[model samples]
Target: MNKILVLAAHRYPDKSRISKAAIEAFTGLADVTVHQLTHAYPDFQIDVEHEQNLLRNHDTVILLFPFWWYSSPAILKEWQDQVLTYGFAYGSDGKVLHGKKMMVMTSTGGSAQAYTPEGYNQYAVDALLLPFHAMANKTGMLWQPPALVQGMNDATDALIDNGVNYWLERLQELRGM
Candidate 1:
């Protein structure tokens, strides 16, 4: 069975309702490993060897984060800077992640409608996340379609339930990969 690693990054995990639930639910999956970035590197000091080892062991890597200020949390960027190093991830001999699958699963405070040209955010979520796709490509990992949970700032019970279901579907797809 292929192991899946979820690098979950949230600045305030407890305050994020649906994210907390999603993290808990995904953590229960047999082949999945959910690593909370903020919890791991509270001091912003990442253990590069350890993080790279996690990537080496997992076949699929899922970047589970909140869309904070149109970007990922600080730790996630720190992770990329530290863990995805020259000799490990992208040098002449660096191909540890080659052929692996990478996915983006992010939540937004605004609704889906807000991420359109006609909407306030003025761009599609997919458009905003092209950088992730490019990152996956640069690292020689297959980029999977991103799953977005929107309007979590005012989530109803129904929205939360749907978010759970959406995550379940993504997990199922991960197993197949």
Candidate 2:
């Protein structure tokens, strides 16, 4: 089975209703490490080497975050900026992440309708996440399609649980590949 690393980032852990519970749901799962970026780097000081080491150890990487303004929270961006350096995540000597799999799992507070040409956001969530696909491509990681849940701000507990299960199932499928 392929080991999976979940890099979860959220702005408010205490007030979280979706992302935090999703993080908890993955607890105790074998071969899966759900690393919370907010809890790990409270001051936003990411340990680059340690983060890189974690990436090196995992075969599948899942970036889990609450969709904030159609993008990831600030800390996740910071983690990428710090950990994905030259000669490590890319470039001639950077082949550490090559052939590994990666994908995004995010909960958009808005409804699916909000992410459309006729909606306020004016684009699908996938369109907004093109940068991540590019980053995965640049790093030579296999870019799996993202898993997104929308209208989650008012989601029921059962709905949240179902969403979590769906992601877990998807990850399990990836592990076999």
CA lDDT for candidate 2: 0.90
Please write out the lDDT profile of model 2 over residues 9-110, one tens digit for every residue.
999865777777777777678898989999999999999989999999999999999899879999999999999999999999999999999999998988
- Number of the top TM-score candidate: 1
Per-residue lDDT tens digits of candidate 1, residues 38-105?
A: 99999999999999999999999999889978889888989998988877888798899999999998
Estimate TM-scores for all models: 0.97, 0.96
Q: Roughly what TM-score does model 1 have, to 2 decimal places?
A: 0.97
